[model samples]
Target: MLSLQQLSKQYKNSELALDNVSFDVPSGQVIGLIGPSGAGKSTLIRCINRLIEPTHGAIYLDDVELTQLSTSKLRKQRRRIGMIFQEYALVERLSVMENVLSGTLGYVSFWQSFFRKFPEPLLQKAFGYLERVGLLEHANKRADQLSGGQKQRVGIARALAQEPSLLLIDEPTASLDPKTSRQIMRLIKEICKERNLPAIINIHDVVLAQTYVDRIIGLKAGKIVFDGSPSALNASVLTTIYGKEEWNTTPACEEEVSIAPVPNFQTKLELAI
Candidate 1:
C-alpha cells in the first residue's frame, strides 16, 4: 500500500503546485488522477517518486517512509516504483529489447550494465514482458521505428521489466489514436489485475479513466475536490473540477470513441500537466 500524509509541493516563486494533497493507493487498485490543467496531478506523481521534492509531509510505501530515505537509499527503493511517461521515453537508438533491459540498470553492477551483460533470468523476464505487451515481434526493432502505440507498449514492457510494486503512469494514451488508447488502457488494467500492482495513472481522458480505472480522483487548483467511483461523476462534478463549461464525454463514432483530453490542465508550475 502507498500512503501520502499531507503532501504538498510549493515552487520557488511561492506557487503551490500541490496544496496539502493526501491520498492512499492500495494493492491491485488503479487510481485515475484527473483534473483540469494545473491541478497538480503531474506534480503529485512526480513528488511521490521524488523526481520533485515535496515541501512538506511524508510519503509511505508499505513499511518504509519514502520522504525520509537518503539519496542512495531512495535510488534503491525507486526500483520498486515504475514510471510510464506521456512521450514514451525510450532511447531512440536502442532496440526494443535493450530498452526494456534498461529497467534493470539499477540491479546490475556498473560493469555488467556497461557491458550489457544481464543475467539469463533477467533476459528471460524481459522477453516475457515483451510478449506480455505484445511487442516480442518488434524486440529487434529500434524504438524510433515503431508507431506511437507500439512505442508506448515498449515503454510498458520496460516498466514491467523492473518488477515494480507500484506504477506511476503519466498520460499513457495521450499520443495514440482512440482505438490504440483503448487497447493500451485495457492492457494496463489487465496487467494491474494480474500482478496485483497498485497504480496511480495521471490521465486526462475522463471517459477512458471511467472505463478502465478502479477509482477517480479529481483535482482543481492544486486541491483534491472529488474522490469517487466513475459512476459518481456527473456534469455538476465536472464543473467543480474543470470549472463551468459545456462538458461532453461522449464519442461521435459508435465504433471507437476518442474523446479529447480535458483542456491542458496544468498550473505551469514546472510540469503538473
Candidate 2:
C-alpha cells in the first residue's frame, strides 16, 4: 500500500537523518521500525507525511508520488495517512470527541472547523472510533483530564477517525507504563489487522515489537541494517542495530512480566464504510 524509493533526508547544515531507506508495506501489515536514539526512526515517519521535507528521493502511497504533489494536492493526500505521535497531541481544552473530530479537519471547511460544526455522520463515525479504542464513555471529558494511557487511546481514536489507508505511528507507547504500553501495542496491532490498514510503527522497545509486529526493520545511523521477521531478530542482529552490547541477560522485571490482553472490541467497531 505504501512504498519508499531511495528516501533520504538531511537537515540544514546537519548530517543526513535518513540514508536511502526504501521499503514496501502491504495491506494490513504492521511493520515495526527499531533503532537506538538518533537512528532516524522519527525522520522516516515525518518524511512520509512531509512533516519534514525529504532532501531527496520519493515516497509513494498507493502508487501516488507524494513528493511531486502541489501543496493543495498534498493536503488532500494526507487525509488518507493517519499519524500517531510519541506524545498524545490532543487539544488540552477540547473534549475528547472534539479532538477525535479534528482528524476530519482536512475534509471540512475553515468556518465549519472554526465553529466545531462537523457533519452528523462524521460525528457518529468519530464516536465509533472512540468505542473501538475503548474511549466512548470518556468522549465528553476534556483531553487534559485523561491519564497517559487514556490520552493515547484518544490519539488512536483520532487517527482512526480519518479512515486512513496507512498509519504512521511514532513511539506510540513511549510515555506509558510497560503494561499500558503493551495494551496500546496490542490495540494498534488488532485495529490495523481488522481495518486492513498498513502501518509503520517507530518503536524503541524491540521486545514489544517482536511480540506484536508482523515484521521488523532495524536501523543504525540512518541506514537500514536488518529487515526480516521478528523471529529472525536474534542477539547478533540486535547487537548490530544497537551496537556492541551484552543482550544475553534479560532484566528480571521483563522476564517475570507479560503483556496483558486487551479487551476484544473488534466486533463493535464498524470499520468498513
Candidate 3:
C-alpha cells in the first residue's frame, strides 16, 4: 500500500543518508527492515514519514504522492500512519489514558485536544487499546511511573488508539530487556495479524525480525541489498549488508543459541553454502 521510488536523501553537506532506495509494502503485510548501524534503516523510515525531508524522489501511499502534499494535507495523511519510537516517547507527566488518547489529536479539534476534551467514543477506544496492550490497570498511572516495557506497551496502545492503516515501528524493543523485548515483539506481530495493518519496522536484531515479520528487507550504505521472505534470508546476504566478513564471528548469546539459528550467526554461516 506504500511505494518508494528512487528515494534519496542528502544532507546539506551532501552526505547521503539514503541512495536511490526503492521498495513497495503491500497492504496487510508486516515488513522488517534490517541493516548494520548507519545503513540508513532509520533514515529510510524517517523519509517515508516525512519526519525528515527527502532530498530527492517520490513516496506514494495508495497512489498519493506523499512528497508533494501540502503541509496541512500531509498532517492529515500522517494520521493514517502511526509511528512508535524506540524511546517510548511518552509524555512523562501525562496519565496513561491521556497518552493513549493523544494518538487521536490529529483528528480531534485543536481546541478540544488542547482542553483534553476527547469524544466519549474515543475515550472508550483508548480504554480498549489499553486492555489490548495489557495495560488497562495502569490507565490512571502517570507515564513516568511505568517501567520501560510497560511504557512501550503504553506507546503501542497509543498508536493503536490512532486506528491507523499502517504502523511504523522503529526499534520497538531496543530499550527493553530480552524477555520484555520478545513479549513486545510478539504483541506487535499478533496485533498486525489481527488488525491486518500493513507495518514497516526498522530493527537491528535479525533474529527478532526473522521470527516476527512476513518479509525482510536488508539495507547497506543507504541502499537495499536484499528483500524477500524471512526463510530466504541467508548468511551471504547478511555479510554483504553488514560489510563484514567476520560478521558472524561472535559467540552466540545464550538467548540466540537456544532458539532456531539466527541467519547472521557464525555457526549458521558456517553451515550455509
Candidate 4:
C-alpha cells in the first residue's frame, strides 16, 4: 500500500541520514525496522510522513506521490498517515479524549477545532478508539495524570482516531519497561490486524521486533542491510548489520541477543561434518 523509492536525506551539516533506502509495505502487514543508534530508523519514519523533507526520491501511497504535494495538499494527505512518537507527545493539560480528538484537527475547520466543537460522530469515533486502546475510563482525565504505558496507549488511540491507512511508529516501546513494551507491541499488532492497516514500526529492540513483526528490515549507517522474514534474521545477518563484536558479546540473557545460536564447542564439532 506504500512505496518508498530511492529515498535520501542530507542534513544541513552534510550528514546523510538516509541513503537510497527503498522498500514497499503491503497492506495489513507489520514491518519492523531494527538498527543501532543513528542508523536512520527514525529518519526513515519521519521522511515517510514528510516531517523531515527528503533530499531525493519519491514516496507513493496508492499511486499518490506524497513528496510532490503542495502544503495544502500534503495536509490532506497527512490525514491518512498516523504517527506515534518515542515520547507519547500528548497535550499534558488536555483530557485524554481531547488529546485523541486532536487527531481530527486536519479534518475540521480551525474555528470548529478551536472551540472544541467536533461533530458527534467524530467524538464517538474518538471514544471508540480510546476504548480500543483500553483507555475509555480515563477519557476525562488529564494526559499528565497517566502512567508511561497509559500515556503511550493514549498516543496510540489518538493516532488511530485519524483513521489512518498506514501507521508510522517510531520507537513505540523505547521508554517503557519490558512487560509494558510487550503489551504495547501486542496491542499495536492486534489493532493493525483487526483494522487491516499496514504499519512500519521503528524499533530499537530486535527481539521485540522479531516477536511482533511479520517482516524485518535492518538498517546500518543509513542504508538497507537486510530485509526478510523475522526468522531469516540469524546471527550472520545481524553481525553484518550491527558489526560482529556488538552481536557476539551481547549477553545470552539480554532480550536483544541475536536469535541465531552461538557457535559453542559442541555446535562447532557438529558443523565439522
Candidate 3: clashing residue pairs, number: 0
| TM-score per candidate, chains pooled | 0.91, 0.92, 0.92, 0.91
Cand. 4 TM to true fold: 0.91
| Clashing residue pairs in candidate 2 (N, C-alpha, C atoms within 3 angstroms) | none
Residue 165's lDDT in candidate 2: 94
lDDT values for all models: 0.87, 0.87, 0.86, 0.87
lDDT of 1 by residue, 35-150 (tens): 98778889999999899999999999988899989999999989999999999999999999999999998799999988989999999999999999998999999999999999
Task: For candidate 1, report its TM-score.
Answer: 0.91
**Predictions: Cα RMSD each:** 5.1, 6.9, 3.3, 5.3
lDDT of 3: 0.86
Q: What is the per-residue lDDT of model 3 for residues 1-273, given as tens digits with 9 covering 90 to 100? A: 899999999988857889999888888899999888888888888888799999899998887899998999999889888899999999999999999999999989989998998999999999999999999999999999999999999999988988888899999988888789889998998999899888999887777778789999988888889999987776677777776565446465644565644554424232111
* Superior candidate under lDDT, 2 versus 3: 2
lDDT of 4 by residue, 125-191 (tens): 9999999999899999999999999999999998998989999999899899878988999999999
By lDDT, is 3 or 4 better? 4
Q: Which ten residues in a row have the lowest lDDT in candidate 3?
A: 264-273
lDDT tens readout by residue for model 2, 68-185: 8899999999999999988999999999999999999998999998998898999989999999998899999999999999999999998988889999999998888878988999
Runs of candidate 1 exceeding 4 Å displacement? 248-273
